[model samples]
Target: MTYGKFAYVYDELMKDVPYDKWVDLVMKNTQKYNIQGKRLLDIACGTGELSIKFAKKGYHVTGVDLSEDMLMVAHSKAADNGMDIQFYQQNMAELEGLGQFDIIGIFCDSLNYLQSEQEVLDTFMHVYEHLDDKGLFIFDVHSIHKILQIFMNQTFTLNDEEISYIWNSYQGEFPNSVEHDLSFFVLDHKSGMYDRYDELHFQRTYPIEIYETWLREAGFEVVEVAADFESVSPQTQSERIIFICRKK
Candidate 1:
């Protein structure tokens, strides 16, 4: 999806997301692993939230996302924050032109949007190419168990004075996948009416073994597998799985 109108309201809807937690994870891992450089590439960095946070922490941050509208919003946000971050409109699976980075991240389960194994592998290969030798690559995904147990066949609703939404998730055609159907209502102040917008988003994830194998095939050394922001191995019921890898 292009994110069109959703780009405008994305931050408002995601206000509760723990962006600082992601930054802390990166910093903690960097210190633990003795990573020295500060150059960072944030893939699928929606609206520059995490990117800005990273920049604030002294990293030279660059962000990439597929949606032009999202990039537009990201650019405006960076400008308003007096940050000099570079925002690129590019597909993560086909990354190019940008120089290498000491750390590359695809946080917030953004990798789930890749529809095929080939796309995931391609993204890994490109990320490997764009990383400095021995550089860290950190990412997270919605665990298969969570997709099946929590999202599939689920309906969620949020009601607020300014904005509200009804979200439904259904099993996708692919294994360990789910399709989200979202309808949003936003109050229009001057018109005294509510504007409705509908969006469909698809996400898929593979088993942990599959991800490890693909990363190895792309010349990366799988370092750690953490669950739900904890520095521990994933459990059967972990909703989010984090992978830490290093380019070899």
Candidate 2:
């Protein structure tokens, strides 16, 4: 979904997210797998946080996202940091004209935004086509257990002078799916009033085995499945599931 005004406040809302840990995860996996290449693609890279981090680490990074507004923010951030990262506006499932990369990532549970299983598989195939042979493909998703046990029927709220939001999560039509309804109140300093807006987002995820099967069908060899930021297999109540695959 297009982020709309949410793009402007995205970074602020995500200020506490562990972006450094994600970068470290990629670095650790690359080293462990003995993969040698500098080219990296960050798909669904919201506002270029991870892309900028990767660029700082000397990776030739390209950031791609479906929202023009998000890409605009990413481009501005990259330029502000004196970085030369290519930011593209494109759907992950229909990736095109982007050259091959040593690593492709869809972090931050971005793949869950896809509405259908076919979309996920199509994205995997396109990612495979854009990856170098034996290149790594890394992504994460909210685990089914987390979706059911935590997100479903949950309400979360945040308050700040500049920004405040009420987030409601409801069980979606499909299994392992949740619809996020968010309402934001941002203070207009000059007017001394708050502007309100609402955003709706839908996300779905499958069992780990289904993801592995789709990766195999797209000609990728599943290398590892880790939970959260750990290098161990996921437990029964793991919140996030990370998959590391290699183009074979």
Candidate 3:
């Protein structure tokens, strides 16, 4: 459950990600479905990046993540941008008491962190419970192909002005899973000091059919499954697969 230093540098390392595409896709779905309510809940909204964008689009946004450090950074960013976004620290699998939302989103492969079929089903059920009738539930996960082919034996590195990192991916001890061992060297600009931190994260994904089955069991009608950032069928070689569902 430790994000470690990656919790601090997550935004910087992911700066090149196409967050605008996520926003655009969500907006497009809202328009296509005639979803007019403004309330939105972003599950696993790490650092609240996409939540801020939704808020800018005139939606009342609430972001929930398990990491307090990430929530702190999210709060700072919201303050800096003069945005009124509510951030909560909670586990998605046990989320409760949050009133219904017109739309709920889990993006950036966040669902993979559940690491187990039961947890995934529980999370989906909770999401279903919290969504208003006929509401939209949009999420994306790393395709099984990506997990087996690209991430199973990958080593990636990133060097930046504030942080340098070595991310090593290995086959997980569990079946159909991957583990990430991340080492980060962060610099303190004012004090001229460097800090080293290590973190272990685990992610696992099932086939698209399994996800579809679980969504249906959780009271959602699968609306669409598309390639990442596009409303098209996902190819086998695609890295990410998106699922768009509507609550029954």
Candidate 4:
């Protein structure tokens, strides 16, 4: 998936996303697990949105992503905000060189982008390798219910003065996967015209049990599993599954 232009409009389209809920989740879980260190590694940290948030909260943040374009946007945002954050271009599955951190996050269901079970397992092992002995691994993913019941074969649209997009979701070749074909229109003030672009995004998710097993194989002890930012158990239709784990 190319994020050349999507990187620029991501934050604008995701303005309604409850980023702070992630912040609160991290803080509450870290405190609950008795982790007091501030260093954090944000994997697949697109545009550094949550990385910057963690930095503002006094965490020593390092952000990693697969897209150089996304890292560029993140770097610009960090510099503009006067926040000191380290941004790197690296795929989450092949993450390396970055040392252990007090906390590691793969938020925004970014893991769903991994195309294979081995990639997901590799990511879990890498996260285990790069986590402090007492650190926490916090991440979330689209639940099976959400992928099948909510996103499958859906068409979504947004029309605005500055930007607009038509998103079509259909079944992917892989099981429990969704492919999103998007066409975007952006108004240009310089010439009073609209620039059109297209991008395809692929996302797939597995059952929570599959993820739990991978976590164990990667030498992690599952601490908790939550749903939709709630502290209770995941219901039949919960859209998101959050995993809390520590180094085994």
Candidate 5:
């Protein structure tokens, strides 16, 4: 329920996400797979960015996240944009009674926040239960390559008028895991003062084959695995990986 300041500044920091590409991919795959109805549940749908996009595109979209702070931001954005999106505060690992959907998405590297493989398997099982037969499940994850090559022992900073962030990534004790130490300096527009806040997030990724195996165990038919946002062959040295799966 507490996202601290990470939920508040999440959108600003992730302004570069290629949401249009995700939408395009969803549309194309849904059509190709004959997923007709528009019911969709976006797990860990931070701020409802892509959820609202689907709503605008005529999907009955529901967005769920663990952070009430993030859902508040998502609600405000939906109101501002005049989009009707149902945003729920819920954990993805144990999604319950969330009815069936023709499409389910877990994008934006949100799955990276899970700290363990058990959590991942539980989440996959929950998604399988909520998906209609042959429903499409599309998501993306931070590749192991990214954890080692890009984030390992990395220090990065972002500066802007409304918010500033210093992010440091360290190798986790376990293989294929990374820990993020984030400090934020957010400006209060009315008070003209900056408040400092901090959050620590842990992430780990298994091999691609592991995910495929788990998806199959969860009753999903594994489909294609593509690099990050690319549709075809992966670009050399890709840092992100995408999975397009279907319910069996």
Candidate 6:
């Protein structure tokens, strides 16, 4: 589950991801819900993209990720930007040591990487333990339609003079899960050759009801469940589901 070489190339490949939308979601809900604290925790905050963005928005941001390589990149970026974000290498399910936060977010579909229901529930409970009273816990996951209909058995290719990639998706062992097999080729200018790297990653998601129930079971009150950053209930073909909850 290590990103290995993928850590360095992640930002370039994910340049089109809606990072601003996630930050907007937090600000919108914080204002709407009257959350005033500036302390924020970014779970699975790969390479600290959202963490740095949150910091820029005046949040006292702390980032946690399982991959040290990703955290290394994040730390360097934060230092370069003169940001004081605290980056920690830790698994979200077993997250500890860091104190409570006013807002805890698991962005970029990182929650989907959990392999089992127990781990998901454990993560929810741990997040509850680390949130201040009435703090917000926001996360998003890939909708089932996206996993089965849009991604399953799909092959995607990216071609560039400097970098190229071939990505394939297949059904995973767990229900509502998909495995991504990626091969990346980066051109070495000096050698006039390509250095190839391969990675396999698994992601799973469940019915929205299941996530809501888990949040409540972990002492949270469901504030909103929206699809694709819109404040509307999810429809049949929604690609992403977002959840916003408040610690009770």
Worst 10 residues of 4 by lDDT: 1-10
lDDT of 1 by residue, 1-248 (tens): 55778888899899999899899999998998888999999999989999999999999999999999899999999999999999999999999999999999999999999999999999999999999998999999999999999999999998999989999999999999999999999999999899999889999999999999999999999999999999889999999999999988
| Per-residue lDDT value at 61 in model 6 | 97
lDDT of each: 0.95, 0.95, 0.91, 0.93, 0.87, 0.94
For candidate 3, the lDDT comes to: 0.91
Candidate 4 all-Cα RMSD: 0.7
lDDT of 4 by residue, 59-155 (tens): 9999999988899999999999999999988889999999889999999999999999999999999999999997999999999899899989999
Deviation (Å) of 216 in candidate 5: 0.8
Candidate 5 wrong stretches, greater than 4 Å:
233-236
lDDT tens digits, residue span 1-248, model 3? 64655777889888998999889988999999989897899999988899999999988999999899899989999999999888999999999988999999998899999967999999999999999988999999999899999999899998877888899999997877999988888998888987888899999999899999999999999999998687689898988999999999
- lDDT for 44 (candidate 2): 98
Q: How far does residue 30 in candidate 2 sit from its true spot (Å)?
A: 1.2
Query: Which regions of candidate 2 deviate over 4 angstroms?
Result: none
Candidates in order, TM-scores: namely: 0.99, 0.99, 0.96, 0.99, 0.95, 0.99
> Cα lDDT for residue 227, model 3?
86
Q: Model 1: runs farther than 4 Å from truth?
A: none
lDDT of 2 by residue, 1-248 (tens): 87989998999999999999889989998998888998999999989999999999999999999999999999999999999999999999999999999999999999999999999999999999999999999999999998999999999999999999999999999989999999999999899999998999999999999999999999999989999899889999999999999999
